[model samples]
Target: MGAIICAASLVTYTSVSAEEAYTLTIKDHRFEPAQLSIKAETPVTLIVKNLDASPEEFESKPLRIEKIIPANSEANFTIRALKAGRYKFVGEFHEDSAKGELIAE
Candidate 1:
């Protein structure tokens, strides 16, 4: 019962965007929105949805975050924006074309 409740809660939370989530779509061998502008030091959730036919690994070094979102699936990660700069991320599955930048302000 507890497990089921927890699972349900998680599903509900992800399905409903409580706060402004920086949504990104993995398509066309690139990351849409190209650049993300966010407040510095605030923990923000990045909801990544891979709309392609293959999986994508949303990996960030400065943010120290990584998550694998299967094809036609969605995944998210939360990180506190640090110093103002450009943070780069790439998809592990398609390292060459799938790439993006997050600009913190």
Candidate 2:
């Protein structure tokens, strides 16, 4: 879990919000929570850790961010939610199965 915590801390480190930035993990072919509720319009950090030995891509069209998370590595990005919306994203390399979402509040 060293990588996961590192990814999360990378995200949290950039934040100055009282709401607190959160860490999201991707492992076992799934996004752990699969769904997330975050403070809307607040600058949020998403640290994506890919535990698999294969490269994975993370994307959220509604959130307008796409990142390539290397095998056993992580990617960090910032997003500001404006309102409640379901942002659907997935691994481009494994789009058929590696999928997930972001539920903003």
lDDT of each: 0.82, 0.76
> Over the full model, what C-alpha lDDT does candidate 2 score relative to the true structure?
0.76
For all predictions, the C-alpha RMSD in Å is 7.5, 10.1
**TM-score, every prediction:** 0.76, 0.74
> What is the number of backbone collisions in each predicted candidate, taken in the order shown?
0, 1
lDDT per residue for candidate 1 within 65-95, as digits (tens), equals 7888888999878766568888988887788
Which lDDT tens digits does candidate 2 get at residues 28-97? 7677677777777676777788898888878777778778888899887777755777778787787777
Which candidate number maximizes lDDT?
1
Q: After superposition, how far is residue 103 of candidate 2 from its true place, in Å?
A: 0.9
Q: How close is candidate 2 to the true structure, as a TM-score?
A: 0.74
Clashes of 2: 1
Candidate 2: minimum summed lDDT over ten consecutive residues — where? 14-23
lDDT of 2 at 60: 73
Model 1 TM-score, all chains together? 0.76
